[model samples]
Target: MRQWLFALGGLLVWTAHFFAVYIAASLFPGEPLASWLTLGLTLVALVVVGWLGLGAWRVWEARGEDELRPWLGGIALMGAALSAIAILYAGLTAVFF
Candidate 1:
């Protein structure tokens, strides 16, 4: 059950990320971002997603352990932090770039 829950959350995160990129590209089709800046943003997004995958892996590995709270809490905190950072980056990019 815990495994399934983590799997579902990961899938949802992936789907959201896909749509987010689509929406961003659509909205900012003609922005003046440097090629390197664009590449860097892409890399940052990948790192955020990678962190999510790591969190999911951690939860899955600790499923049978008694310390599930720490795993879940850390994942939640990381996810929130990633999301906040991404959103701030996007807003700043659109506003100033």
Candidate 2:
């Protein structure tokens, strides 16, 4: 439902961050500054998504099975996990490529 929007906020941020890094890497290949820039951006994105995910989990716990909250929390946590993995993969690729 509408609550899912809140759940997906972290995911949305992550998608944007992913593409930003992708384009930056493409546009500035082999540049030391580009690597550093992508790394910094990736770190910041992880922190933000992680915080949002934690907040959703805490709220869900406090709500105690309330309608919609659990779904929101579950999805948020999943999104956070996905984002972290995606970011790490992207980061390693950025580093090694």
- By TM-score, the best candidate is 2
TM-score of 2: 0.84
Q: Write the per-residue lDDT of candidate 2 for residues 1-97, one digit (tens) a residue.
A: 5676677877787898888898888889889878987988888888888888788778667666467777777778888778788877887678667
Please identify model 2 stretches exceeding 4 Å from their true place: none
Alpha-carbon TM-score of each model against the true structure:
0.39, 0.84
Can you write out model 1's per-residue Cα lDDT over 16-88, one digit (the tens) per residue? 5545655666666766543334445555555655666677556546655568655664665455456545644
Clashes of each: 0, 0
- Span of ten consecutive residues with least summed lDDT in model 1: 33-42
lDDT of 2 at 22: 84
Candidate with maximal lDDT: 2
Q: Cα RMSD to native, each candidate?
A: 8.7, 2.0
